[model samples]
Target: MNLRLYDTAARSVRDFEPLQPGRASIYLCGATVQAPPHVGHIRSGLAFDILRRWLQASGYDVTFVRNVTDIDDKILQRGTDEGIPFWQVAMRNERAFTWAYDQLGCLPPTYEPRATGHVPEMVELMQRLIDAGHAYPADGDVYFDVRSLPEYGALSGQRLDDMQPAADSDAQIKRDPRDFALWKSAKPGEPQWHTPWGPGRPGWHLECSAMASRYLGPAFDIHGGGMDLLFPHHENEIAQSKAAGDSFAQYWMHNAWVTTSGEKMSKSLGNSLLVSEVVQRVRPVELRYYLGSAHYRSMLEFSDEAMSEAAAGYRRIEGFVRRAEESLGMPESVPVPDAFAAAMNDDLGVPQALAVVHDTVRVGNAALAADELVGAREARDEVVAMLDVLGLNPYAPPWAAQSDDGAARRALGPLVDVVLAQRAAARDRKDFAVADALRDGLAASGIVVEDTPAGPRWSLAEEI
Candidate 1:
């Protein structure tokens, strides 16, 4: 498969060629662990997850590294506010992020190295830049000298002269105002580690550069994060990594933001929809579908109406798979359609790929209506395969029995059986009125009961 991706650094879509013959490496900027992940944050993970799935589907060994910024200014502040240790605050939010990722069916990363856990790697990276004359230690703080690197703004496409001063750290002793902190000086109440320069925590950008190099090697294939990180975060990463004489990421991929009311969804905006909160409104699978329905590069506008529409859309695909499985056998190992593959290869065009899935669902439903079980099974197979690639397969584990709605169905099964048994006794006693009442009650509760040769089977009533 000739995979293509839009490199944020190049500002153009290009064919993706892995550095290794049959292996691909990806470094996704993971959570900072200051708070539970909102949908806006998890969207980046979902986008990269789809990309990883596609690469694996296309027959490449993928090594994915998604790191956690467990030590940050915000994390320290949160701990101070809560009157707890910084690691405790970080660990609490980190578990929340892990839960959200798993709830959305994202495959776990190959290695999820925490920022605090890799202080040595971060120190080594800072030392390399300092030795290369691109960084310096001042007043117990290490800063990356931005002007020392001629290609500082290459990734973000802004010339160094046109850039604003780096506001990430104090500029008092910097050689240039654009210089950013590599390691911050320790504050009284914050976490700290010993380094040659001084005792301090790694800067946000420095952690990613160090962790990515440690796991994906000196050079990797793709580095990804949200569009908001395009500035100082990723820009500084490029400058320090390349200035240290190591080739960093081959391609830079960034996902667009999840917006609300024409504004970026952020905690400060008071419109942050946590994944845990959104999943309460919709099933985790439905939420994932809503999040992944749009193009990764497109801004996903979050609205209840849009989310409901996406949920309804997924139910259509899911309804077809469930119904088709009953008439035929369980869907497994079907050939993915050429159209779906083409769409995915074209920069992970999920919207187009999902269109192919819905079209196939239409075909499958039509075949089932016509009593063409063979054709229905074939269509179901293809649909299931496509959904599996997108990590939205309803029949798959975690989404299968673990879904809350599915669990409810399991819990209510015995009660429904009792009702059916009562109705059977009413029928035996020639009480048609009572029998009809039980049936009506079931129907009113959205349960449809059918007496088969085996026994009474029940299903949820189809929505109009």
Candidate 2:
């Protein structure tokens, strides 16, 4: 099956032909670890995750690389306020992001190269640019010479003459105001590493190039991130890498930013919905469905009302899969429809693919109702595969536990005895509300409180 993806380069959809036959290489610019993930953060990754799923489903070996930016101006600014090292802030937020990613069912990347972990690679890349005369070092700071790269504005479609200088420069080092930083010379108390030039840190655009090249190679199949990065961030990456004599990304993919109240969601707006808080309100799979229901280039507005609407649509798919599974007696066979393949092949049109799934359910349900068990069997199999491809199996409950935690619970030792004593005291005093609330709260957070015949035993709920 041919995979058609929307390439931001062409501003149109095109068939995806891997550089290496039957394989894919992808580099996704990950979050800067200054804050935890919000709904907006997940949108870009989940969109590409869907693309990864489809490619794998079509028998492509996928190597996905997502980089973590540990060193940033924001982390330094916040750290200065808190009186702690900026690296500490980065580590704390990186763990928070890992939790958010797991809650949303995103696959772990093959390599999660932290920017701080790859300074040597960054120094090497900077040297290539400098040696190529595309970058020049002045006053210990290395700046990319935008004029040296003729195709600088080709990706962003912004000409150098039209770009206004962001801020007034010192007027001594930079030949053109349009030139951006490749490496920043170390300032006192800032995070720094010893480089060929001096002690300094890598710039934002240079980090991705170094990390991507180290993991995936000089050229990869696709590079994706939020549409906001299409400008200076990704454009600089293209300029810096090509100037260094390495072919950068072959295909560029950018998903539209998630919006709220008719505006793009951003930390600066104070309107962002954190992923952890959202997971508390809406199930992860439901949230995924809501975020992914529209075209990748379209803005997704999320609210309680929007979530409820998505749940309604998702419930339809869930209801169909559930009924089909029950009535068909777990049929092993499912027929693939030409319509299903065609829809997916057409720029990965999820909406059209969904229509085929629902159509299968319609015919599958009717056949089951009429006792046409054989026809129902084929439909059931097709629905299963479709759900698998979409990462949403309607029948699976949202909050299911995937681990056996009984041994760890038993190892609590003295804490378990103390809790048991408290439970007995609560029963004797008739203060059942505290006891009940404790049990119920645990159950709500994916812990199942079971009043077994022996005693109160707790375990994890079924993981969806």
Candidate 3:
């Protein structure tokens, strides 16, 4: 394969060579599900999902591991706020993240491990680091002695002297202020696991290193996460993992963030638009297109106007696909256009690839207009092939389910009409309470009723 990926570590687009021929291993730092996902949170998943699909299309057997940090300080805090257990908070938010991923049409990872489930692996890893004299325990907490790893900042291109102290735990016990925690000693009312050093919880950086090594082995082909993690999170992972004598990830990839109004879209910023809410305004597939249309490395600025334009673009493609299918039957799977492949090969350049999709759609529409089946079919097949690689194929499983929903909506219309008629009669009889009750019942059932000038109009509520 001639695919080239921009290695964040190397800071260049390099040819992708699997560790073992025909097999690729990836460990992506997944959700730290303390809260429900926003568009910013799922963009990384969508970006990597496209990469995984492309690798499969390129004939590589891929083992993808996306770990969930089910134990975290934020999770515990959220639990405290809600008067629930930390695990409950984690599980609830994790489900929300999963629903968002599925609604956006992301494929499931090969294995989605939780940090809490791999305490044994983390213990073993800590032992390895301790034995290597790269880590030490003090005051019931363990810290990775950053000085021990001479190549500590290679991945993130930072100098050890200029780095800030890792405030993950108490600084007084650490030999160096920069020495980050491998494990934090238990506090009152917080969950704890037994470790050789003491009873405590795994550090954020440590959990990912442990999970990745456990699933993909000590060393793997690629490690990916959002760009914000480059500093302390990813750099610390490199320091401890390599200090323990594992070669660790061969390549690093980081997707840029989604921003709104020149600020990063984050809950702390109070500017995050929830995925569940956004999908109500547009189809889930349209949201996917908007998120996935940009180059993975480029920052995507979020706005309603931009989203509307993206939805229109996706609708054009969908309209062409539906029309082509009606005339030529289902398009046979074929190789994507060379232009599309070349764009994808060059660092997963999706924007250029999407231009190709739009170009093909235009040609297909023209062919359909001229009553040319052969040309239309060729264009249709090429478009399907490209969309399939990008996980935007409309006729595929999850998106195809929308057709069934359309039929259900059609069936629901008459039933809702009958109720509205009864509601109208109640209103005409001067029984305001009965009419109000009927309207409220329909609203509770996700049917919105509007008393328009033409009469009563009903529609189903928007679904995430």
Candidate 4:
């Protein structure tokens, strides 16, 4: 495989070589499930989803494990605020995240392990660290001795002395302020699991390490998450896993955040655009195209204008695909264009790859206009193949069902016809101004009115 990826640990683009031949193992740090996912939250999922699709397209058997942090401080807090059990809070929000992922057409992971369900694995990993003298228990809590590992700060590229204290636990009990908790001591009214040290819950960073090892083994091809997790979460995972004498995460990949008003979109910042709400304004497939259109490593700034522009851009490609299929019927997907594959191989360059998609769309549109069946069919095949790699194939399952739904068109027909009748009456009376106004109004609402020789015809605008 010629695929190369930007490794966060190496701080450079590196050639991707799977640990095992013809197989790729990826563990993506998934949602914490404290609340419904915002667009910012789902961006990471979509970014990694593209990677998963590309790997499969490239002929690698991929094992993708995306873990859920079901038990966390925020989850507990949300439960308290809602007057419900923490488990209930976690489950409700987890479903929301799952829905968001599915709505955007993200492929489900090979194993979606929850942290609370894997206590036994966490306990075993904690025991290994303790026996190896890299972790110790104090006051019913297990803490990883950060100084024990000489290469502790390698992942984050920070010197031990310059680093800030690990704020995961109280400084009074830890031997060093930098030591992070493997297990937090059980607190009143909180969930707990029995461990040799005491009854407590797994720490945030510890959950991922244990879950990744459980499904993908100790040494896997890649570990991925958002850029915000690079400091404490991913760095801690690296220290604990390596200190336990395991070669974990051969390559580290972190996607950039979705920002709003120059700030990272977060609930605390009060700038998050929820996936459910955003999809109400735009089609789910259009939202997916907007989010995945940018490079995975580039920060995508959110704006209504930007999103509208992206929707228009996607509509152009979809327009060509639909037109070509009408002229040439459905074409079998051929291998992706060389330019598209080359861009994808170069560190998942979606921006460049999308350029290839648009270029093909242009070619297909020209072929259709000239009534060249052979050229149109070839372009359609290439376009479908490229879109499939990017997980944006409109003719594919999910999106196809969405596109072919007659119920919506049927429901909308009567209302649209009423308006069309009024417009026709105004036109018959030579009230051109009123008729044009009504037609423009319908177009603004994404309804196109065509005055044909047979009769007036109405259809939903493609851009919407």
Candidate 5:
């Protein structure tokens, strides 16, 4: 099980040797809880899940910690706007995120600590930062002074002098423009806790630092998140942790963004697609295949053609699964090809890994047709084992509901009725334009609006 991963700190791939003998600790940044997760978020989860599954399979005891950022300015604002407690909005979306994770077949972490639940730890961390002169109190806010930490920009590789100040940051809280907050003073309508400094909440970066250290330890194996957080988010985490005179983690891993139509996929962009919505169309397992078919560090631009290809690819695996089941009566042992292990060991090169899957399926199918059940089962189990690395269990989907698809379609009756009425009005007025537009709108919402003789009938779209 010799494996190596690309380390962001070193800017290169190195052999992954744990500090202790057979133990791996991972601290992956989880959802912010501001909104439901989009396709972009699933990519990071799947990439790390690959690492986690690999380590676990290699006889290593892995402690994975993925935090839920239940407290943030956006959440506070949303709660205020909706007239609900801040926790309400975060909890609602956190559940949605978990569903999305299930839909995408991403394995859940060992410890999912919420940011709000660990305020005491966060305050303790802030106190250490303040005592070490790495951070200071300014007007009720505690800020991490970027100039105070000499190696501040190491993670992002950006120098303090060369960087421009962030426009959205609090100008008064920072001694220098590059400095960021460790503790945010509670404003009216925002959630707060009592602390020695004042009544306030933990800043975004410090929450991860505190939660990660508490769960994974001061020094751990990998700390991963999206590449966009490289600058102030991860850089600030590095500074605060080091200032506390403790190492944060061994390898820094950041997954690249997901793109759609040449733009970064995001809910704010209105072009973002939800993993749950996607699962409604295709088998959630196939969505995992589609996402895992690309390199972790490369930007994957998703489209209908790519999805169709993934569906076709998944059908091949399904055929192998069905064939393996049929040939269980024969006697022979098929071996898993070395190509699969080789590709997977190379920093989870799933594109190549999937190619190995194809080859294994081809070989196993030939053996199965020749009445070799023992080897076919072994080969099928081998493929399933590799699939586990990417969090696709091949048995059950995380996003799959216990109820029938028919029942789920019935649940969408009200929404479907609204869409049909709008579409019917457009058709009765002899305006095919509005009718077509209505149909497209319904399809985008995961509803397939079809025009039948009985009128518009709706079902969940297959490629949602």
Candidate 6:
């Protein structure tokens, strides 16, 4: 099946064809780093991660670039509010976002460029826009001449006359109220960079256009961010990049927001749940499953009930995988089921894909119940392969053997060994009934034993 994705610019699902055959490039707008990210913030990361994995699985050499807006208005404000340097605030929160992404098993990007580090590129882009008569420098500030580009509002489908003022800078300094800033003049106690326009930092939109072009070239396969960015943020990026004579992104993909009470979750709303807080309530893998369980274009309503339910669902899948591994002496790789592949191919329909995973788990459980080890192994391997694509594989690194879980398993292993010795001694003395009872009791307590060529190995019947 073809990978058909919902391109926001096209406003419809279209088959994904890379600009370069066997190669895919993606630029995802990452954190601004004013504060630690909430689950809502990480949802986009997980969604795009699945997309990257799917592309690689389908034989594409993927170049994924996620950028950090380290020096922004919000970060500067945060620093003033906390009596710290803006750079300090940016670093603290950027590390938090990185930890959250890694905890959820999202693959690291090929290049995670910081906006501040690419000022030279931003300066080049601004110069190009100015040279093309699409931008102007005034009073130590540079503004994109929105009126010069007829396609200024094409990305967000808004006409310049009908739109609100750009509000990115002082209206008196701009050629047109709709013209957003390409650079902002430095203020007292704020970071500054020297550019032809004046001594100032790069504008928010200007940073992405420059960074994307620098790393991914003049054009890339996909540009992605949360749906909220579709307005002025992405709109301005398109205007400046296209006006500067770059092909820019071939496809625009936006992930829907995670909302609470039908409102977008935000720090201002006082409804945002931090990633660190939520992970304390559920395992990281389960949190990932919950976040990625919905279609990328669909809103995920935040709630404890919904999150708990998702956790339980993942536990069921994890339980089956653990059991199957004990009986089969470790699962080998298996092809994902056609139904699972089809679901993923259809715009990364993770809900449908998860339904397929659970169904396979049920089949594997039934096979195990009937002592059909071969059938069980087949179902387990397929489920694992599918999970691998979704980044939910319980046995994979990062998610595998977490500190507390590993400690618990390591402590339990010795106790189980003692019980196995008792059972073995009972069988050696020909006390078959006592040995059977001990084995049955252990099984009742969620421990499964398998006699292998090496020895009798044991594992938790239910995943930890």
lDDT of each: 0.89, 0.81, 0.90, 0.91, 0.81, 0.89
Q: Write the per-residue lDDT of candidate 2 for residues 1-464, one digit (tens) a residue.
A: 57788888788888898999999999999989988889999988888877787788788999999989998889988899899999999999998888877666677888999999998898999888888899988888899999988888999888999987778564468888888888989899888888878888888889999988999999899999999999989999988888888898988999888888889899988889899888787678778888877777788877888887887777666655655665566545333477877777777777788888889888987887787878877888888778766667543323334222446666753554566567657867999987777666666666665563356655544333
The regions of model 2 sitting more than 4 angstroms off are: 168-172, 329-336, 394-464
Q: Which stretches of candidate 1 lie over 4 Å from their true place?
A: 166-169, 403-440, 443-457, 460-464
Could you tell me how far off, in angstroms, the CA of residue 46 lies in candidate 5 after the best superposition? Answer: 1.3
Model 4 lDDT tens row, 277-331: 9998888888999999999899999998999999999888987887677668886
lDDT of 1 by residue, 1-464 (tens): 58999998889999998999899999999999988999999999999999998899888999999999998888888889989998999999999999999999999999999988889988988888888889999999998888888788888889988866557456678888878888998988667898897788888889899899999999999999999999979998988789988899999999999999989999878899999989888888888999999999999999989998998999888878876777787777976999999999999999999999999999999999888988898899999999999999877867986643777689889999999999999999999999889999999999988775456778876443
TM-score of each: 0.92, 0.84, 0.88, 0.92, 0.83, 0.90
Residue-wise C-alpha lDDT for candidate 5, range 1-464, written one tens digit per residue:
57888999999998898988899999998999999888889888888888788788667899999989998889988998999998999999999999877667667889999999999998899888888888889888888888887888988888988888678547855788777888888887577899888899888899899888898778888899999888778888888899998788899999998899999998788988888777677776777788878898999998867977988898787657644754463323333357776777788778888887777788788777676766677778777666656665455455234213757677788768987888788889999998898888878888776564446656565453
Query: What residue pairs are clashing in model 4?
Result: none
Off by over 4 Å in 5: 329-336, 372-378, 396-464
Better of 2 and 3 by TM-score: 3
Candidate 6's displacement at residue 6, Å, is: 0.6
The residue-by-residue lDDT of candidate 6 on 1-464, one tens digit each, is 88999998999999999999999999999998988999999999999999999998888999999999999888899889999999999999999999999999999999999999999999988889889999999988898998899888888888888876555547887778878888989998888999887799877899999999999999999999999999989998988889999999999999999998888999889899999999988889989999999899999998988988998999889878876777787678878999998999999988999999999999999999888988898999999999999998877878775623667678888898888999999989999998888889889888888775557877665333
Evaluate residue 369 in candidate 4 and report its C-alpha lDDT on the 0 to 100 scale: 76
Q: For model 5, which pairs clash? A: 278-464, 281-462, 332-375, 333-375, 334-375
Q: How many backbone clashes does candidate 4 have?
A: 0
lDDT comparison, 4 vs 5, better candidate:
4
